[model samples]
Target: MTTRADGRKILVVGVGGLGRAVVEEALDRGAEVSVLVRDPDKLARSVDVRRLAAVTVGDGTDPATLDRAVAGVDVVVSGNGAHKRMAREIARAVKRNGVQKLIWPAGGTNAFADDGVTPAYKLHEGRFPGARDIYLAHQGCIDAIRQVGVNHVIWAPGRMTARGARSRDIEVKVDRSAGMYVSYEDAAWVIVEAAVTDAWDGHLVSAATQTGG
Candidate 1:
């Protein structure tokens, strides 16, 4: 893990809350960051313009739109949501453009089986019917990416709070635990790290705080 200021070209597709954090981290890491946003005025007012290399304003789900956003990009880290099929188009464009590195968000539930805690997940599942829907959509995105055979990383983080401390000493697991949780900022950092690292190619990594560290 060399967190260097290499100024690599990176495209982040969504400039909202979570996406904003990703864009900030990418800029903090000295990458040439571009964003695909639906509203440029909002983004310009919201984001630090000095760090933005370019902005493609459109719905990221469209193949042509994604193609334009990803053109000449080395790596693409997406914060797009379940509604717009952003993951699907990102995968397709990554394949089309011969860009190997792609990182997108998935759900912690889908990464782990019901192991009896489906009850708790189901509690939230009931409150929001779309919880399960969103998870399923992420699963579909995972399947699509795997089938497409692109170099990718899918991040699934457990129950999260806002920013805590930044530590690379985080837990990564394929199975869910009742005790597992992560900070939102830490999760975003993990996604950025895994996206840039050569060691995590084609791997799905879950983020959690280091226990008893």
Candidate 2:
């Protein structure tokens, strides 16, 4: 599939497992990629940081750092965990900088299920105490993105494995009916594809690997 990321300036916040996968895929697709990280040395040790277009060191919540990172970017892909404050800050920066696209990883619970109730959300409510707060916070982040009026895609990959080979076949659903778990690599592929494509723009997609693939 043609991602249309060639020569595009893409900013990735948080270079952890999923973030690293995103960076690699974005680079593979020929995007001019930059990363914003708190620990430049740690990221340097993991990947060939020298290949990146730029690497700015600072906290994601820092407005000045975000401003610097977001400048002149075509799209922003943030895999900075579930911190509402960080999401808010990134959304603000994207809007303030007039970036056109934002791709965020909102958990499976955030995607509405076919039965009209998100299964993970019900699980959090029924079993995990205080987990609802996290869900609500993620919702707040989604709200911020929507309120900003930028074209966005919220990727909801429910349960993800830390390491695995990338799958050639994957499934993506607008509803929460996709598979339960996907490899980090596969999730990253979906995210990068979504970032550069308009198929899922202004929508939330649930992505997972196909079984027995």
**Cα-based RMSD of the predictions, in order?**
3.9, 2.2
Residues 152-205, candidate 1, lDDT per residue (tens digit)? 887766566656445557666543422347766666677677756766677656
TM-score of each: 0.80, 0.90
Candidate 2 local lDDT, 1-213, one digit each (tens) = 646579989999999888888898889899999999999988998769977999989999899999999999989999675777787788889999999888988777777767757545665566767557766767778887777677888887777875556776788887464755777888888888887878888878887877542
Candidate 2 pairs with clashing backbones: none
lDDT of each candidate versus the true structure: 0.72, 0.82
**Model 1: residues >4 Å from true position, as ranges?**
113-134, 164-169, 174-180, 209-213
Give me the runs in candidate 2 sitting further than 4 Å from their true place: 2-4, 116-120, 123-131, 211-213
Q: Which candidate leads the pack in TM-score? A: 2
